[model samples]
Target chain A: MKIAMPDGSRKEMTVSVARIDEILKELNINPVEVVVAKNGKIVPEEETASCADELKIVRIVHGG
Target chain B: MLNDLEKKRYSRQIRLFGEDGQAKLKKAGAFIAGAGGLGSVISIYMAAAGFGKIRIVDCDSVELSNLNRQVLHWSDDVGRSKARSAKDTLEGINPEIEVEALEETISKENIDQLLSGCSLIMDAMDNFSTRYILNKAALQKKIPLFHGAICGYQGQATTVIPGKTACLRCTFPRAPPVTTFPALGSTCGVIGSIQVTEAVKYVLGFGGLLENRLMLWDGLSCSMDEVACMRNPGCQDCSALIGDANYKQEMSK
Candidate 1:
């Protein structure tokens, strides 16, 4: 299986039931502030682990 | 003489922004919540600047104490509803503009009705509960909301542009438990002016708003600073409006 990471890059991997956060740690990318958008819609924080396939992650930053 | 009237009526500002900015002022509509302290200054400026429509909502009557910062009322105007006095004063300043005052408080139930047709909502309210309610309503309706709070010589202003900016909840998830605080008249004036400036900028589609920046003022120090903030993806109020059911369940009453 191929997983889409937050930076719009894809990584080929074996099938595993891992959350996006776990996948991020595996890639050594620890985003401090972020929201998950899977297939173009916002995924609730509570539902982040449930999201699967072709997901996009959005990061929020403190801006002035 | 028509140009003369424009030049004389807005002579100071015309020299600063020119006629295009003045025309923008003539077509704006603003909803101001709380007709006391800060509201008085905001409404007066909006009306004087020729905003086409001004809506003011406040349920309280003027007391002698309010005379300090609420300059729109006179000794005779005491005992009258703040909203009513505000309407009369604002209309007197610019009768060509439409000023509507509702002797009602804005709650979760009635906020939408009060804000209908208004391009921006100004939270001149003193209490946190009402401000929070107005904040949620404004974000849900996708209306720009300018928030101002004053305590003594300290006050802050922030412009929340729905999906485009960090909302009130993103900065302060819960209201400060204190309901009453000592405030100086200059405090309200400083903060209210900033709020109205942001409101006008939002209405005129001007350069850019103070989005994502909490502008804090300290009159005692004569200093101002802009602190950066971001949308707390877990903020109970805005997160729910953005479609987070879990946060909604946690905050739902």
Candidate 2:
């Protein structure tokens, strides 16, 4: 899977989890701070993410 | 009917939307939930655009540090309640419209009374808990919610039309972690303007609203992106409105 950060950095990772939330948990990613898009589609956290999925992590910067 | 002065006052925008559209704007009201960075900008534009009524609430007092982004307050207003300061500025911008400022924190207890008779809710708060409150209130009342948030050079906005689009809770089932967020006034400007644009289009009954999509602005890259969103079938806040006929009925009011 490909990890794309909001800052334009990209990295490759082999998925080790079935669900997006699990992958997020494995990466210690806070679900509230970032949105995970799998293969260019924004899926809900509970949706499945396979080893072949390309995950893009977009950070959500919430303030006023 | 537009009086000669109102016709003259909004002549520029009238050209864009015509007398009926201008009249739609003039007959609508909005409840803005904060007086900080996003609230200040949203109220200013909504008032200047001739929104019939603007009710802005905030419990905090202006601080010297707030002048950078909370443009409604200045050095002279450092110690004044943000709501009052916002009212003064918004009224000065367009006295023809009603500007009601409340020096109260928005909560579940007071949200109903605070938004009564308003046609729309604007989420300009600094926190998500309050944004969620605003979201539920909008849903229950069948009013639209124009959402916007910012930190540092990045900001995001989305519109929630009860029963028609994704509610805030559906988009983020959990609240974002609270942090000492850095905010630039320009980021607020970008997001706030998008909110007002969606709101105006909503009231005017034309153009494409920012429904079911979160618009993201990244100043560092000078680029914008949108993430698609959909309503959660089991959304705790707004599922009741999904199939309610009253939701559609109230929207036409």
Candidate 3:
């Protein structure tokens, strides 16, 4: 599967995990700190990511 | 019915939304959660746009270091309370509207009383803990929250319509580590303007709100991007409210 990070970089990774949260954990990214979208639609934390061709993870935080 | 002075004051915007829209704006109350960088911009715009009543809360005193981004406070106001400075500046911009500035820290205790009668809540807070408090309040009141935050040249904004769209906790389950962050005034202007725009649209009942979308702004690249978002069924803040009549009806479909 291909994953796109917030910095506009893509990484190819092979994982046998079915859930998106597990994939994020394998990539050393905290699932609770970022929003994950499969293809174009946002998926819930427990949703399956094994069938997705493209994945995007965006960190949601700011200073104000 | 707009008086002659108000009609002339908001002529340009009235042309966009008409008398009815202007009236709607005049009848709504907006709660601003801060009086700092983002709050400065949000309150300024909300006041100028005629948001009838505005209640802004802050506990900090102005300092020389805050002059770079907190536009509402001037160098002479270095020792003054931020809420007082903000009230003076907002009233100076638009005397026709009512500005109620409170010099108190926003916490779970007074959150409900502070937000009473407010039609909308604008998130201009500096920390996530306070933002979470405002979010939970908005959810309980079934009021919309226009959220904006800025750090240096980057900023992000989103709108939360309670159970109708993704709540703040749904999008950000964990708060980022708190630290003193570098900030630029222009970044606050960008995100804050978008938030005020969302509030105006929501009050006027027109245009597409930023529902289920998180807008990210990068000033360095001069690029803007939006990421999709959705409600989390197990969200700690808003999950229980999902069983409300309105949410249940929408979910049933």
The segments of candidate 1 whose C-alpha lies over 4 angstroms from its true place after superposition are A1-64, B1-8, B241-253
Which candidate tops TM-score? 2
lDDT of 1 at B244: 50
Candidate 2: segments with Cα more than 4 A from true spot: A39-41, B242-253
Top candidate on DockQ is: 2
- For model 1, residues B1-253, the per-residue Cα lDDT tens digits are 2255655787777776677777777667789988877888888888887777899888989899888788888889989988888888998898777899999977888888888888788888877678888888887787888988887777778898777666787766545545356767788888889888887777667666778776767677797755565777777777766565543553343
How do the candidates rank by DockQ, highest first? 2, 3, 1
- lDDT at B174, model 2: 79
Task: For candidate 1, give the docking quality class from DockQ.
Answer: incorrect
Candidate 3's TM-score reads 0.93
Candidates' TM-scores?
0.73, 0.94, 0.93
lDDT (Cα, tens digit) per residue for candidate 2, span B1-253 = 7788889999999999999998898899999999999999999999999999999999999998899999998889999999889998998989889999999989999999999889999999998899989999988877899999999999999999886788898888778799999989999999999999999999998899888888889899999988787778788887776567776564345
Each candidate: RMSD: 11.6, 2.6, 1.9
Q: What share of the true interface contacts does candidate 1 keep?
A: 0.00
Let me know the TM-score candidate 1 reaches against the reference structure.
0.73
Question: What's the true lDDT of residue A9 in model 3?
Answer: 82
Each candidate's DockQ score against the native complex? 0.03, 0.70, 0.58
Error of 3 at B22 (Å): 1.0
TM-score of chain A of each: 0.53, 0.75, 0.81
Second chain alone, TM-score for each candidate: 0.89, 0.95, 0.98
